[model samples]
Target chain A: MNPNGQNAETRDGCAAKLDVCGLDLYYADFQALKNIDFRLARHEVAALIGPSGCGKSTFIRVLNRMNDLIPSCRVSGKVMLDGEDIYGAMDVTELRSRVGMVFQKPNPFAMSVFDNVAYGKRMRGLRDKRQLAEVVEVSLTKAALWDEVKDRLKKSALSLSGGQQQRLCIARSIAMQPEIILMDEPTSALDPIATGRIEELIGELKKDYSIIIVTHAMHQASRVSDRTAFFLLGELIEFGDTREVFTNPVDKRTEDYISGRFG
Target chain B: MKKRVFLDGLLYGIMALSLCGVIAVLGYILVYIFRQAAGSLSFGFIFRSAREGGILPMVVTTLYVVVVSIAISLPVGIGTAVFLTEYSGNSSLVRILRVAIETLAGIPSIIYGLFGLLMFCRFLGFGQSIIAGAFTLSIMILPVIIRTTEEALKSVPVSFREGSLSLGTTKSQTIFHVVLPSALGGIVTSAILAIGRVVGESAPVLLTVGLSRNIPRTVFESGRTLTIHLYYLTNEAVNPDDFGIAFATAGTLVMVVVAINTLTKILTRKFKNSQGDAS
Candidate 1:
């Protein structure tokens, strides 16, 4: 099964949708991610959980090369997206478009709701009015926000509530029709109800897109993700089915961290 | 408690007195000017030629200077500011440019008059015309516009840039579509401030734009601005009645500046409200 699966997923493909091998990230002298090997299959949800400064955010940023914006940031090892090296021969903008990101804080551009949802496509030079309208409607609907925002499409995105704004951010990502979506603490800034709504949206989204989320909540990881990877001090300590990782004994640190001993 | 209350009351009383004192001084100037101009501020005095007691030539010349100088300087100033704030980050060249701009802003207006007289009037052979004055005033206001616009661009939130970029837009596109539009209000405010400076400046206008009383028909022809006309009216007055004309000219200058500032404020408010980016 291993050889046949690896052979079939060899060319122009990953063993999973994304494959990272011995990834090391650095910010000048600081080693942010020491060495990480991770994988995400198609149409699945993977949650990255750890304490603060555990490099979960940095790890996902490398997936889309978002760290390229920081002057002092550097990375090594292979990050393969559909079997293509993200750091070699691939344009940063193209990589970003294929793997869209959502920040912890809802960052909808200070434009109308229609413009905000259509921002990704518009930036890529999609200017046809009817096409843009359709994309906006579909993306918003998929993010479960079209009904809430339909009447106010011309209103400023900033006028929406915090949860709705977050959903708009999700819609903005989905508008790109990305192969994978990276969410960095997407709901850490939201209230409980907003967080629950996002967690539910993630459940709906995984059926269509490979989703990677970095979360602080233990239950969010257990409830939303099929696979959970516990990171500690930039090292991947445990990776397996979310149920098994949560319930059974794994490494001491993973067990201790999950049992509320220490992060 | 009583001592603290009494001291706080005294402090506020002193501040209020200072504010009233400032307003009283301004009010006194306006009252005195309006009284002096009562005899000279009729429509005929404004519509007739300078030879026939009207200052229409000066008014036209002032308009030319404001419009031409703003047209030349506004784009250059905004471009330089965008480069400084959005592109150059914290390089040594940028540091030097920032220092140079600060020095330019701090130089005395009389010095600018001397430089303009040498550079535009004699060296460039514009020869003390409205064109010369417009060039000088354009240079004079560059620092003011650049400094204010850079501040405006910096005030745009970091999240706006991140939001635009993470969606796969180029850096320049992010700046133009998101950051620049967000900073438009501040840029307009900067331009208004430059207009105020250009309107109030007298020495530079007097040096580069000559005190010609003729209604000059072209920018190349020598003409006098309102500030220069007012200066000449005050300097060469032979009769007490002549002083009335100077007062009227001053009043006209005041009205023009007030009208420009008010009109722009209303216009920009409407613009920002329509775009829904003011907040």
Candidate 2:
């Protein structure tokens, strides 16, 4: 914690819950992340703020090994969660189960509303009808969508509005019971009202799960995240509590970015 | 705008007139064949082969050849399409495969027949057998199946794949579960088109299978398809009876094609309804 009652960089005050040490990522000839170091505490919502093409999404994707699918992508260094090195001899499947992701756009399966929420459980081989039903109800409730769709569980997920679909995607991630959820501009495609709903959902979600989000919206970072990390040119420029970083940023790049002085 | 509209209408008129000419030719052929053969299309005429033999056996042989050819070609062609469209990485090899497939598609059916006759029949010592004809037809239709299925698979949206992957499902599972189901309509349509091509083929069957008006009780035996029967009858008519049999056989072939089209439409509708419900 800081003089402003906010967590600061360069101390184990939050005990280094997720330590990204000397991380470097590359896409073929393009170096995306350059020797980055950052950390996230348990049950903390850390917002990554940067302009377009600054490698924020690339950095978060490294957490779940999603970037490995790209043929020319290469990652090095350590991403440790609770003292366990995530990239060291750990099964990718097991790693993904602990760390889930939500894309910028909502991607509900071409399935019914009920099945959309039940997908992860079914993928893990849960076949009991009653158990799936209970899981759907609980997850949807947590996502603030249970009442709106309780009567139409069998309806196509595509029939829902944009906001509802995004919430449904969040519900889907929640149903997997992951310890950490990575969101890549999850509300950028949404309207203000919808964005507000997701912000409320994220605030509630952080009580139980750690969240790392990349956003272009600075106000959103200030309102929703517990801490904020400002990035520029594939490097971490500042990492501190949301209020302190927004009100009193240390790095010149961070202050410039927050003040709308150019990306 | 007015000139462009006039030009568009003129092109549309020319196209429709050309298509109508084709339909008129087909209609005239049907009417002529029916007028000549309707009297001879009796139970005995159909259930029986040539007065030299019964047409029943010939009809059975055509069915056998078509069924066997479809059985062998459907799985292999589909597998090839899936591999080319989905599994193959973007490399010079895949480009070479695309080029090879295009070349195979352009090759004439007669070339396939000649190759089959020389290779499958002569080398395997199964000269003029139904299996020889089936192998020939399978290769001739291979390009059709591969091209159509590849197009169908490509028509599925990439968003469906991304959604499945985000859920942590593997690539194979996403393809099998989501992509294949969405492309089902186009796949069945392609299969029906292949069947139409197979049923109407005459020259290839003649060159490979030979003209035997006998039922193929075994795949290794020589037999004749309906088109081949019609061809031989038109060429070698010892009596007016043979001519009538050819007309009636042509009518039966047209009927078979129509029936296949109707069946495919019904199947596609049922599938769409079920998929809509599932989603």
Candidate 3:
């Protein structure tokens, strides 16, 4: 046991897979994310729950430097992966490959199912058809979509149902074999049954890959996350075990939010 | 409410009338040209040289000019559009470039003919050749290609770009692999429109490529395009007995334009269908 009355083996067994320290982000003159300190251990699922426009989405984009595509966006803090500052030392492409992202909308490329799954590998210069096929099958299996789409690998990805398309997106990210996956409201566009399947998939995924999910549903946060962080007005109001954050929040704002008092 | 309903009906009727007016004008011209030229429509008139009872040399020259001009303009125009839409920052320079492009699109083709005559024919000593005419037509059509291609590229959803970038692909790769393929239908439509303009142009071809009756053997050889042939037949009254030939040439030109327009519609429809199936 550690002096903080926590199990040292659980707390420090593995170093943080991704850490954001004193992170501040802005879009032109509008401050989107205030100073933030967050960490995710390997094989753990961290859920960021907040009301709309509270910077949860922006914070996740900061992880992969996806915000770099926005001309007016800027960041002034250290985003560390394996203790090395991603912004300062890591190449953007390398960082993105290491930290894959799934957007709110299921954005399967206008391509065949096989091509969609094989795109990342192709981008990384893999040309062997056998290798690409192996990666695609493995990824789709991991995303739990292989059984549904195995017969129609050559069909257009957009032909699939909405939920299936979302899983294909997950398979696409998984094919890259990233250490972390950032999902921004990935299930918001899904039906309840589809959302349940994704939640179950997230449970299975946390055994191998760290996940940082930003969701609007409070119940979803409590159901899927090991650790939950509450954001309010671009601030991290509380960060702790999911049970404690939901049942006994330290901040009055966090308490009011979890109990559905106000956003 | 009754007044508003009446106004709405009036506006709709006016729009319908305007559409009918456009279709009537187009249909009337087609009928007139077909009726006048039907008597002279013969295989020999189509295949024989201009010196013979045909306008085949002029047809060949027009084709040459269209091919060479499109070859020159397609790559450069599409490149400019890609740079403008994807790479160009929203700086003052970009603003100036956009304004300049719009201004170029509005310039008269006669001015382009003069410039081509001075630059390609006299100064460069490629005097009154098919190549000079091709270069002039390329410059005249460049703005059309660029503007249309830029619009097409812009219509590609930003989400597609984001999806590609998130997969760690470079911007150039994303553009070449995804954006360009998606915009190809529009780009081809633009090229066909430019070709239509090139085929119909008379003043510019007349100034750059002289109204010679013989088929051009090389880029540097003088030739006469169909439009220039029509102009000569009309103005010089080359043979009062061969008025049917003039009408036949006019009919062929109109047919070519109509063919190109039909091709544009077909290509766009095919692309839209494929895109629909994909997404």
Candidate 4:
């Protein structure tokens, strides 16, 4: 059992791998996320669930500073990775490498399967052919794709099925050995079978990495996450153990959302 | 409804007629040029220098100008495009640069020739040489290259850029590795189009690189290109012999242009196939 009195099945007693304190984000004059405080423990899967425009995706993007790409987007408040304030102390590149992201669309680069998996390592200047091959093999295996694609590492990544493409994207991120993986609706574009495969992969992945997934499907959040944070109109309506949030939400809005009364 | 149908039929007929007109004009020109040049075009006419025999000097000059101009313009044009698309934040500076490029594109080639005469031939002391002509042609084609490359770069999806950046790759790295390769087909098409424009120009070549008959050994020496050779031969033709040389030069220029267009088509197809495989 964890010494911190948290449920041993859900969370370890280790310090939060990511901590966001009083965070607010804006795109131009419009506020996107307001006064959000969140913590993600090491090796736990925390799912962010909300309607399309409730700032769940925005909140996750802030974790990796991907919002910095927008010219008018601004953030106020601290996003702490490990112990360092990412905006204040960490280089953006360093922050991104440590916190990799898999996007909603399966965005495998226009290259061979092997090259796509090895791209991050190559960017970090790994030149040894053997090391790249090993990383590719291991990452693809972790993504549950190595067996299917092992024979065709030289083939184009685009030729893969949509599910396989998404997994390939996951492998690409994993190859970087990031501490956390932020997935923005990674299975939204896939079939139910593909979604099941990805959900299973996530269950396996949480043992090694802290994962924060933004999901539109309530069932997915309940099925896959240890914890759930629900948002409505840029506000965190409620956050707690996933089972409790679904079965007995403290906030009426959270209950309404999960019950399909209203978004 | 009957009136609308009639109008649609009328528009379709007009469009088909316009398409036929364009094809007919192109076909007529090709047939006429080939018929005129068939008797005069020979191995000796292409191989020997103008003073000794035919348009060898002019062919060599045209090649030098095309190579030098493309070499000078391509890097500068692509760099400007990258800066505008990747670095600029939709600022007024970018707006002004775009306007300037548009203006350059709109200016007549003759004005560029005059500008070359004053700036390169006289002021730069490159007087009536292949280098002066090349410099002028580079300026003439810079806008074409810049505009086409910018469009190509812009066509690369935003998701690709974001994905690369999220992987901790730098902006320049994303552009070079992901964006540029995807846009390669468009870039090559634009470059070949620019080469076609350079080859067909006459006024600019005449003013910047005077009608010298000798084959140039260096860029500083004066030489004549195929277009200028055709122009002078036709202008001075008071006999059948002079007319035959003019027709031969015209045929050669048409062949070069046709070759360039064919190369562009083949390359674009190859690139599209490769991109299909990758994506």
The TM-scores, chain A only, for the candidates as listed are 0.94, 0.95, 0.95, 0.96
Candidate 4, residues A109-178, lDDT tens digits: the string is 8778988899888888989999999999999999999999998887888899999999999999999999
lDDT of 3 by residue, A1-263 (tens): 12122223236634677778899999999999999988887787899998899999999999988999889999998888998898886788888888988889998987789888898888889999899999999999999999999998878888999999999999999999999999999999999999999999999898779899999999999999988999988899898889889989999999988888887
Q: TM per model?
A: 0.91, 0.84, 0.91, 0.92
Error of 1 at A238 (Å): 2.1
**Clash number for each model:** 0, 6, 0, 0
Alpha-carbon lDDT, every model: 0.89, 0.83, 0.87, 0.89
Q: In candidate 3, which residue ranges exceed 4 Å CA deviation?
A: A1-10, B1-17, B237-241, B258-279
Candidate 1 segments exceeding 4 Å error: A1-15, B1-32, B42-48, B238-240, B273-279
Which ranges of candidate 4 are over 4 A from the true structure?
A: A1-14, B1-21, B261-279
Lowest lDDT sum, 10 consecutive residues, model 1 chain A, at A1-10
Candidate 4 chain A: 10-residue stretch with minimal lDDT:
A1-10
lDDT of 1 at B219: 91
Question: Native-contact fraction for each model?
Answer: 0.62, 0.17, 0.35, 0.52
lDDT of 2 by residue, B142-236 (tens): 88888898899999886666556666767777777677877887888778878888888888888888877766679888888888888877889
lDDT of 4 by residue, B100-197 (tens): 99999999999999999999999999999999999999999999999999999999889888888898888888888788877887788779888989
DockQ of each: 0.49, 0.31, 0.40, 0.48
> What is the C-alpha local distance difference test score of candidate 3?
0.87
